[model samples]
Target: MTKSARADMITVLAMQWNHRKVENLHKTLSMRFVKTTQKAQTEVDNLESLKQELNISLEDTEQWVLEVKQWAATDSNQTRHRKRRRLTELKKKLRERILQYNTIDTCTETIDTEAACSLSEDVILPWEAQGDMVNLRTKRRLFDQVMLVRRMEEEKVIIVKEMTQHCQNLRQALEKLDHLLHQTKDDIRNQSMFHKY
Candidate 1:
């Protein structure tokens, strides 16, 4: 072969090799990106599931608190004691759940921040650019949902506090009534004995 022709062949081969290397690198990066996205999505899904479970638990706790309030309103000492015990347990459970929710919220926030950072840093790859808008919308929706859950939890805490205060007031009223009844009974008994004498 002519020397120029041989040089041209070598140049073409070099270009082909370089092209293959770029293709392989792109493929590897694409796979890594896919895996990272999938993992983040799975974490989000798990957080959502946990939030649902916590909602169910909060509902149950509210119901129990209501029942305890009703029971405490009655004048029975035994029922009051039972109500207090149940309320304590419910409060403990609520505290734990709240802590768990806080932890989850932190995690959700971290994931969201990471996603936002990644989105900003991402170059406009053909595959990623196509879904960029969709991903942004989804992240916004997830953030909104998390905020809503946090608000709901805050409301639950307020409701519990109000219920506890009401129970305390009811107990105090019952005690005052009992004391007056005893005093009146004693006065009547002493007057009757004086009359008999």
Candidate 2:
């Protein structure tokens, strides 16, 4: 081959080699860019999914809050009614006790005698024995009155215990409501911050 032809051949080969290197670099950069775009799209999809999850959580929390409110109100009303009924029953029992005690006292007063019977009276009359029996019945009634009062007191204590338990349940429900509200608020705040980004 001629020297100039050889030089031309060398120049052509060099240009071809440089073109191949540029093509390889372009392919590598293009592949990297495509991979980066796919990764970004996946990240965006994950963010959307997170937002959807947060929305569902918020909705469920809201429903729970409403349910709790309804229950609290209903329970509160029921407790109030129960307490009032117990008080009324207790008052009636107290009045009954007072009436019975007064009756017993009156009978005792009538039975009291300042003077002893005359020695000529060898035995009590049958009607007087019946009166003594009636007095014994009054005393039994007085004993029943005390028992009733004690039973009423026990019932009052039971009512207090039940009321306290109900109040504690109410407090617990309120605490759950507060916790849910706080969690929802925090979720909303996080969502807002994510959107800002």
Candidate 3:
């Protein structure tokens, strides 16, 4: 082969080798990222499971508290006994709920760590000159998605708050009705007693 041609061939070979090395490096990095992403996903699942359990516990506690309060206010032959029983049960349930909340908080800490790691995983390096524009675009897209998610979460919170308020109003109305009924009964009993005398 001519000297110039041989030199050209050597140059091409070096370029090919460099390209292969870059490709292999990218592959290695990609595999590592996938593993990290999977770990993050597992953490997310765990967090969700804990959150669901917490919600169930919260609902149960709320119902139990309501029942306890109702029993406390009830005027009946066994009111004292029922109130004591309810208070004892509520105390036990409250302790259990506190334990569950502690567990959930621990899980949340783990989730927060995992989330931080996951978010950092996709972060662009300042020195990444070639892909800065593309990275910026990607960040913008992710920001939009995050904003959308926040809006949805806010809407759900509003709905939940409205429902809770409505429930409270309903409970108050029922309590008022019960009070009026009790007053009427007492008034009738007093009148009957007076007439008998």
Choose the strongest candidate by lDDT: 1
Score candidate 1 by lDDT.
Answer: 0.58
Ranking by lDDT: 1, 3, 2
Candidate 3 error regions (>4 Å) = 1-132, 135-138
Candidate 1's residue-wise lDDT over 1-197, tens digit each? 99999999999999999878654654554555565556556655655675465443545434544544454467388877887888767656655654554467444422232233243544332335456243333334444555455555555555556556656766897999999999999999999999999
TM-score of each: 0.34, 0.32, 0.32
Residues 96-120, candidate 2, lDDT per residue (tens digit)?
6545544674455332121212212
Taken over the whole model, the C-alpha lDDT of each candidate is 0.58, 0.55, 0.56
Candidate 3, position 188, lDDT? 100
Better-scoring candidate (lDDT), 1 or 2: 1
At residue 121, candidate 3 shows an lDDT of 47
The candidate 1 region of ten consecutive residues with least summed lDDT is 109-118
TM-score of 1: 0.34
Q: What's the distance in Å from true for residue 88, model 3?
A: 75
Candidate 1 backbone collisions, by pair: none
lDDT of 1 at 165: 62
For every candidate structure, what is the RMSD over all alpha carbons to the true structure, in angstroms?
40.0, 37.5, 38.9
